[model samples]
Target: MVLPTFVLSAALATSVAAYDTLLNFHGAPEVETRTIDDIHKAAVAEGGVVTLWHGGDEKTQQDALKEAFEKRFPGMTLNLTVDISKYIDGDIDRQLSQGNVYVDSVILQTLQDYPRWDQEGALLRYKPLDFDKIHPGFRDVWASWYAVVVFGWTNIWNTEKVSEGPVEYSDFLKPEYKDKLVFTYPNDDDAVLYAFDLAMQQNGYSWFENLLAQNPRWVRGTATPTTVMAQANNSYAVTFTGALGLAPTAPFNVSIPKNGFFVTWGQRAAILKDAPHKEGAKLLHNFLLSEEYQSPNNTGMWSVRKDIPAPAGFPELMDVNSTNPIDFERFMADRERVERLKLFFESKIGSAQGLSPLVDDL
Candidate 1:
């Protein structure tokens, strides 16, 4: 593994770094490098084109990823087609219907949502260099999944719209905000569902209920609500999404709320069990895990690569202290339990994505 180390002072928190140590978890390094540069071009030319069916709609995120991958793997061209609509609907059913697996690898919402992909012989696993750099809560002991990036949800607001509005969490539930609020439909994004779950843990079931009562517009992808906040002059919405960082060129802004509510890299990258392009897929997957491909700034919720310092706009995660981040094994093993939550919530309110045609298509 060509992984560098991350060295921290006695006071890990206050210590400053200029790209120093490479952390090792348990025993393995955070990232691993196989030196594919020699054949990266040859492999691509001989193979032709490669397609990456990724999830989500971040601003510069798509372009940033495409540029990095294409530049590294020269011979092959990358098809950066982000199928945001499917969002892990029915992986098995979709694969069965397609006759073959449709995607190479996927950046899913979270591993806890569907752990069967690795076991049902549906997915493969690969580890990155300095894998140990991340907190224990984010790692996968069984090697079922590895957090490619680190990100989470926090309230975001328009600098302009929010100037006179909320300064904290309680303001978000105010009666005045009304329909002016925009948020990703929780039913569509598992992370959002989990975020609501966290809110339930911190506040109560009425937390989301109050937010809903304010008449927030449900967006398709988690980032859409934040986008609207920046462009539409909307006050606030689920802002901690990666979309906030992707919009570096735009006027939009996202602020981490002062409260204890937070979620990270709500999305995870995993190889499909029956991946047709498993080799190339794993190659691409590991490459993304490397520091070479990630942004340099540290802030937005993205995969926490030691080399790729957090984005300038994002905040390092120092708040993830024992809120009992979901158990990957339990989530993966208890398929029925996840279904029960989805079903119960669906019965009560239905998918927020089902509300509008435009929003649904987003």
Candidate 2:
């Protein structure tokens, strides 16, 4: 029974290799196949229920989504929990720690959270059918998350009040526009924060210093600028999430700076590793990226899919000026730098005023 050391080592290595292969083998044949029909049946077999945590303006869209899902799948039910993305992430942390992890899938604008969760092995690594069709910049390198839509953070002005709009960030500093501009406090919204960051990098900190002298009003939420613009409460908003589709009839116009604007990868979605309804979760995840949901009229968002056309009245993504391509990984990883930048801006412009939407009672 005393074999040579080399022979024994070889035998042990072979056995270990075989064990590793067996351990890595994913057992589900249907999961391997990954067709829409297969996922549908699997979802139905898994009691046909999935809960989603969404961070966006999904309040009105969720109902339409539920009806559509039920119509398509007959028995499946979709549960949508809507709130700020940061709130959803906080809930996920609480739920996971408490051993309840109820939300099956998450669709949110805060992409920085996705990488963090995926690193902790919290997200399921399942790429939908059209994952390859998405632009490389929009999806995770490891397939843990994918951008479902596109949107931007930019400036807007009440056209009736100011017939001509400012085409540059510095334009807001003009004497005539002084004290007439309002902006969503950059610190309050990630998109606005990123936009401010980009503006600083492009135009220098002095741009902010001079602009601060204009006495621009600041609000907490990204929607506040557009809301104020519609009410004619402010002549201009230096930054807000650009969505022309919203209130198209209002006497307002939005514009991205010719020098640059921060366009964002909107509402990235991912499944949880321990999703309660695995099949239904995957099915719903894929359905959201399908041509049907990605259509502008249906979702009111620009699609990430290559074949889908740009939303009506919107320029092609390539045709626009997206200042610096956002490296979300680096942005999220360098927390200290971001904090320092925030401090610098606050020191120059002043601490953000008003309550954060995240903290404000719903």
Candidate 3:
């Protein structure tokens, strides 16, 4: 392993000279194409250490990637720094500003950053081996970043508590469910906020207005609602990217509202242009999108590859009623409106810094 290190310290300060030089750095000039084996050979020759900074808890996800990568490449090491995407982004920005680039690659759910990175010429633009097999909705026009998974912001209910599940967003506003639900704060999660954005387009702002009247308890992390619902303290949750394929064996179970739904494009992954271990980073990025890693058995979320089938019980991308298939370009383009929505949500939901008692690891 790459002597696992964390670069989250706030003390890392910027140097204008370092920033100016490294900011324009792009590892080895771009090439037309390279076969997977060619890429593998180059990666092995480059000392095989690829440091990655990502969002969300590392737990099952990154642990699985580490095992799979070592098993496939033998000598390669994948050192991952897992935390909130916002925090990881901050750390990376500081490191970049100081010209102390530690991470070779970054995969984050913060959709806005991918385009920004591309604009700054900070991303390596090599397409993955199976780039063409990706669904159009998930593809980046610039090819600087691509989705590794497809996730949804929807409802999950405690089967032990709710006899019947909500059919749509408005159902959560009912008197009976008031104070009986928990959710990720809309302001804290862009995906969740996008969900509300879609809901407003379909059901109108009244949906959020009425939902606020019900007063659902809010949590900060996207995964917190599922955790809170499982505790039985909250009967239901209407936020967070739903985990697919995993069988529900406990008190909580995930559900997609039939009336409408929204999906978040998964981690937008890219190799940093100035990454010290560029070849290794390229290998890891390709491996992440490989059929094995994207298989339903390996990933709980839906894979972006069209060749892969959804797990038996889970619905395929085409089967779902995606009321508003998020156009990431448009979503990112409307930053001012998104900020306004966040501010509007904060006015009603109070602070977005919610902490669920059970989710201590975050």
Name the runs in model 2 displaced over 4 angstroms. Answer: 1-45, 57-76, 232-249, 299-301, 312-315, 318-321, 324-326, 349-351, 356-362
Give per-model TM-scores. 0.69, 0.78, 0.81
Q: Using TM-score, rank the candidates from best to worst.
A: 3, 2, 1
lDDT of 3 at 319: 64
lDDT against the true structure, per candidate, is 0.54, 0.69, 0.70
Candidate 3 C-alpha lDDT tens digits along 83-144: 77766777877776676777898988777787777766667777778887877667675577
* Residue-level lDDT tens digits of model 1 in 1-362: 53334433434633312122223122432234556563354346446355566555543346667777777776566666564524443654477446577676677554654354543434454564555665555656644566666555555556555444353555667766776677665666666666655566677767767876876666666656755665654445334333455234434545444564555553466666566555566567667655555544433344455444445554444433422334433443455766666676677566665444224433
Clashes of each: 37, 0, 1
Error of 3 at 282 (Å): 1.6
Higher-TM-score candidate among 2 and 3? 3
Q: Model 2 clash tally?
A: 0
Q: What RMSD, rounded to one decimal, does every model reach?
A: 13.2, 6.3, 8.3
- Which candidate model has the greater TM-score, 1 or 3? 3
Considering only N, C-alpha and C atoms within 3 Å, which residue pairs clash in candidate 2?
none
